[model samples]
Every structure is written in structure tokens, then in C-alpha cells.
Target: MDGLRLENEIEGEKTILMLKERRPIRHIVNIPKTRNTFCKGTKCRKHTPHKVTQYKAGKASLFAQGKRRYDRKQSGYGGQTKPVFHKKAKTTKKIVLRLECTVCKYKMQLPLKRCKHFELGGDKKTKGAALVF
Candidate 1:
């Protein structure tokens, strides 16, 4: 049987298999005209508007979901959260510099120096956040 595949972008990289959940046929939806995609023609070197060539429908693993027993949780395994504890509680990760995304307008903290692809440019702020030296 054909299973759906899910992919997402994480930290400027594509992340696959974020989560798996089963759903009926209607849940699997595809954007129309996605099959035939064309690049956003632009003369700019890297500023070109991106284009979609193909669309992959995300899916959940049936084998993995079926193995889970929701009914048994009420007896001895029942709990509000999976793992029965805060085994998966999200923790704040340490970062170098904190800034807001210009595109998303969301507060984001990132390492000061690591990846070479990114150039450590000056802040968009004029006075406060902007570094003096």
C-alpha cells in the first residue's frame, strides 16, 4: 500500500517524519495544480522567487500507529501525556544571539557563529539591538 510522506522545514533544512497519525481518505489533501509546477523566472542570481516542481502528500505510518494501545492507558498506562511523564517536555536551548525573523516576525535565537552559509550581518535595529562595535 502507498503511504503518505510528511516533510517540514527545520532550521533551514527539510525535516521528514515529524509525527505520524492515521486519518481517513479525506484527510490526505493535495493542492490543485501542484502536479505541474514551474520555476519563478527571475534574472537575479539567488533572489529568484522559488517554484514548486512536485508535491508529496504527507502520511502517517499505519504499522506504527496500530501498535499503540489507547484503551490500555486507563488501567495502568493511562496518562495525560505520552511517556507518562515529562520525558518529552520541550526545554529552552541555549543560543548565541537572539533576534526576530524579518520574514516571519517571530523571535528567534541562534548561535553567534557556526554555519558558513550565513553571514553575520548587522542588526536591523537602529539604536537598541544594533551593535555599536
Candidate 2:
């Protein structure tokens, strides 16, 4: 089949337009909406019902050793004391799941592969459903 084309007449000149070919779009990652995996807590050694949540880094403490040292170094009259990080290569961050044992109230972190988007307890996708870009 022929691709898309357009014909236009402006003033006294005839113009023809051709649309550029589009590249195939990549699909987003799909994960189960809910999971009931094994719990490795001291109270519950067997598989039990656990709450799933995304893992996020906590705020850095001002009283930390590295932060205190960096702040001390920057307080002087000298110019920039330490080198700032600017070389970031990866586009997506690794997904981490924070699993908490409902029985023993124990929490653990589970690291997964890198993904652009992450959803916890989201809607379940069916096979026949069309995907939205």
C-alpha cells in the first residue's frame, strides 16, 4: 500500500507533500497489580500475606558525617571545594519493592530491574485490551 501524501497549490506553484515514516513505539513495562509472596520475617518464616509498597530513599540527615564534612569544607572563603556530580547515564531508575509482613510487622526491600514507570496495586491488564500510548 502507498504511504500518506498531500497535494497543495499556493499562488501559482504546485506543491506535493510526503509524510515521514514513523518508528515503532516501545511498550511500557507491565507488572502484576497485587502480589502475595513469601515473607522472611523472624516470626513468620513461611509464606504469608504481606503488604507491597514502593521503596524510596529517606531524607539525608544534616548530622551525618559526610554531610557535615562537606558543609565544613564549603564554608571557607575558597571557591567550589568539592566536585559536583553531573555525569548521569541511565534514564530509568531501578524499581524497589518494600515488602512488609502483615503478621510479624517486618519490612524488607526487594530490588528489581530498571523501569520508566512503576505502579503498586494498579489495575490489571487483560490480553485483548488495547494499550494506550
Candidate 3:
């Protein structure tokens, strides 16, 4: 014996309506501040505390081989040497976590699932209350 559950068709889709004040449901999609996982470094081969951080790409060097080649090709004439990519397919980049072992200071990257929005160490969401943005 619980709340009343009724099924009704609306807009060609069957929806279930529950009339009761029950426990709120939440969807957890955020990674916590810290995590304890296995470290594959030479110093620590066991599980250790790891500091989680978002992975970011480093600045591209100007003296790279590819850059040098491209510069050489576009030095004199010829408008636009290589083809510039314009058709981007993906809307959001995949999130990557940088896990650093506190014991040995070893760092490794872990890729996460694709999501439209991702927050690291953000505030937890509570049911029935408006999000604080």
C-alpha cells in the first residue's frame, strides 16, 4: 500500500503519474574532489590516494616539426597552403581526468564519457529545489 499510480496516454506517449510525497530522486553525474585508485607507478603499485584534476592541453610549440614545415610551405606564394578544417562534427569535447598519485607524484590521464555539461567538484544537486547554477 503506497501512493496511487495511474497510467494515462498523452501525446501518444504513455506517462505514469504518481500522487504521493516520496523520497526525492537525484541523478549524480559529477566526479568528486578526490579519489582512491590503483597507482601503476614504479614507486607505488598498490592503491593510493590520488588527486583528481581536469586535463588541459598544453600550448603548442612554435618550433615544432609540423609548424616548421607548414611555415616553409606558406613562405613565398600560394594562398593557404594546407586545408583548414571547418566542418567540426562534435559539439563538446570529451572530459579527461588527470589522476596524480600522492605517494609517488605519478600522473596518468583517464577519459570519461561524453556529456553536454561537466563540473568538477561542483555543488551537489538536491531534489525539489532549484539549481543554483
- So what's the TM-score on candidate 3? 0.72
- Score candidate 1 by lDDT: 0.37
Model 1 / residue 93 / CA error / Å: 5.5
**In candidate 3, which residue pairs clash?**
none
lDDT of candidates 1 onward, in order = 0.37, 0.77, 0.86
Q: Identify the candidate with maximal lDDT.
A: 3
Question: What is the C-alpha lDDT profile of model 3 across 5-33, one tens digit per residue?
Answer: 98999889999999885643323358887
Error of 2 at 104 (Å): 0.7
> How do the residues 1-133 of candidate 1 rate in per-residue lDDT, one tens digit apiece?
3556788898899977645555332322222211222222343222222222222235965456543554444447535544555577433322244333233333323343222132233223445565567
Question: Quick one: ranking by lDDT, best first?
Answer: 3, 2, 1
In candidate 2, what are the lDDT values of residues 1-133, reduced to their tens digit? 3557989999989999988765433236555534577877877888877777888889999999999999999996998998989999867777888888888888888887776677676677889999898
Name the lDDT value of residue 126 in candidate 2: 80
**Which runs of model 3 end up more than 4 angstroms from their true locations?**
1-29, 126-133
lDDT of 1 at 103: 30
List residue ranges in candidate 1 displaced over 4 A: 1-47, 50-68, 73-83, 87-90, 93-123, 127-133
